[model samples]
Structures are given as C-alpha cells and as structure tokens.
Target: MIHQPPVHFLGKTLTGQPVQKQVRKLKDLDNIFLDQAAFSAADMNRVVYEVFSYLPVDEGTEGGLFFGMTHLYPGTVGQEFYMTKGHFHTIENRAEYYWCVEGEGMLLMMDKHRNTWAEQMQPGSLHYIDGYTAHRVANTGGGILSFGACWPSDAGHDYATIVKNGFSRRLLSVEGKPALV
Candidate 1:
C-alpha cells in the first residue's frame, strides 16, 4: 500500500504517485505460549508497542498493508495502570467487531455523548462495535488485552495508529450507538 499525500503538504512526487515500495520478507512474530501471558502494568506500554509490529494487520502498519487486525499477543496490552482511552475508526463507512482470542479485560463503552458502560471480557468473548459506539479497552486484570478485530470493511487502516496511543480518539457518529444502555 502507498500513502501518496496530496502534492501540496506532502511535497511533490512529480508523478503525483508516492515512491514505489515493495513487500520483501515478512517479519517473524514473537513466540509466546499462553503460560507466558501474565500482564503487569510496568510492561503494558512497551509490549503494546512491540507487538504492533507483528499484528496481523501489520501491513503499511509495518509496510502499508490495509484491512488488517492483530491477534494481540497475550500480555501485550491490558494493565490496570490507567483507563483505556477512547478512539474511533472512520473509513469510507464504518463497522467494527472485536473477537477475544486470548486473555481478558474490561470493555468500557462510551457513546458520542459520553455516557458509559463497562463489561468484563475473556477468551471466546465477542465484542461487537456497530459504529456509532464509542468504546475503550481497559485492562482490568494482570493479563494482556489480547484479541482480534473484524471490520465490516477496511476501516481499520486508519485506526492502526490511533489505537496504539490509547487516547486522542474521536467517536465520529453517536446516533446509532446505545449510550452504554
């Protein structure tokens, strides 16, 4: 995938197309067995950043691949250290789903209006975010918030950067999401 910024701010590619980039070797992800995933607050931030490089969605994320999601390495995220800040993903349109593959955490659901609700999650847990729903992934335990996301479309391409910071996210539409109801 190429990120050709508009000629004005991104500078001129003369051809208007971004420089050509190719996919070479795929990065090898860390080998973590379930027994190793015991999240502690001190390691939360670093692990999240490190695992981002290996997310299934690590395309342009690593090399510009789009339409991807990460099966969070257990213990890579989720710390009771602080609250899971909020964020949103807007594509041409938006629809999102989170499937818990491993570990557990708390999901804090906040609407555009900022009303909130919280739910505990675990492996096999299916958390669906049908757009319009403002949400946060909180680490309510000593484990990582390892999970997977299913976008109805390629909306997550934009979300890759945003979710990592764990803050500075916007809930584009508040209309459909039930306000933590």
Candidate 2:
C-alpha cells in the first residue's frame, strides 16, 4: 500500500487540506453533565465544542496515526465546566498524547478500576494518556480551550461505556478556580 502524506496543522487550526469536523452542542450531552437543572435551563442549541480531524489513512488501520484538535468553548452548567464526552479506546491498549495549544483546562482520566486523576492543562502542556483509561477534557478558562491529540488510527473510541458509567470524579468551578471533586 502507498504511504499517506503528512498532515499539517497551525495552532488550533488544521491546514493544507480539508478536515472532518464534528461539532458538539449542549443538547448532544443530555446525560453527560452532572447538573440536571442547569442543563435543562441552559440553551441546548449552544455549541459546546468542536473536533477537527485529519485522517490520512482509513480508520482502524494499524500503524497509522490520526491527528486532531479539540476546541472547547468556555461556559458552565451550574458549577461544572464544559467538557467532552469521555471515552476509552476500543482496543484498550492504545495510548494517546494530548498537547495544550491554548487556554486553560483540566485533563481528567479514570482507569479501569475507577480510580480517577486530573492534570492542569495550560499553553504548551503535554499529557500522555495510557490505554484502558477513560479520558475527557474540561474547559475552565474564560476563552476557548484548544488542544491537539494524536493516537493510533486503530484506537477506536468507546463512548458508550462512559455514557453508561460516568467518571468517578468531576472538575467543577469553585470560587472562580477549578477544583476536582
């Protein structure tokens, strides 16, 4: 098979070619957020985040890498910050890397045993996520929180598992600062 060409990206934007974009609105995370009352009263149509992916090879291709950027808008539901729907890799052993390009946030991770941890994400912060862990990002800043991610093309996402079993810990705003609870 022929080799796929390199993909280029600038800051939080993908360049040189068109990418597949997925926008997640507040309504898309009906049961993901912790506060039911805040979720119900908020504007469901408001955009929460967007993912831009540049896939050079077909998904699930071993040895191939997929690159993407997640742009999480600043907002809150009750005291909880805006976040992505966390997921584990379908392969279970596929690790991934995330780099904070801009904004401040938290990288929340939970292992298979339900143990949870979080890392502060700032500009230039890099995080290594191990396999078998469910991971999610929360935007705690007042501006857009953007980050880049790289993982094996074969590392399929398992969102359903997280939907059924939510994260053990949550990142919430406390007196204008982020706190893990």
Candidate with maximal lDDT = 2
lDDT of 2 at 12: 78
Instruction: Please write out the lDDT profile of model 1 over residues 20-109, one tens digit for every residue.
Output: 222211121111111124432234334331112212343224233322223222232121222333456554235566655555565665
**Model 1 bad stretches (over 4 Å):** 1-45, 49-85, 91-93, 154-181
| C-alpha lDDT score of every prediction, in listed order | 0.39, 0.93
Indicate which candidate wins on TM-score.
2
- Which residue runs of candidate 2 sit more than 4 Å off their true CA positions? 1-6
Q: Encode model 2's per-residue lDDT on 98-171: one tens digit a residue.
A: 99999999999999999999999999999999999889999999999999999999999999988888999888
**lDDT of predicted model 2:** 0.93
RMSD of 1: 14.3
Model 1 lDDT, full chain set: 0.39
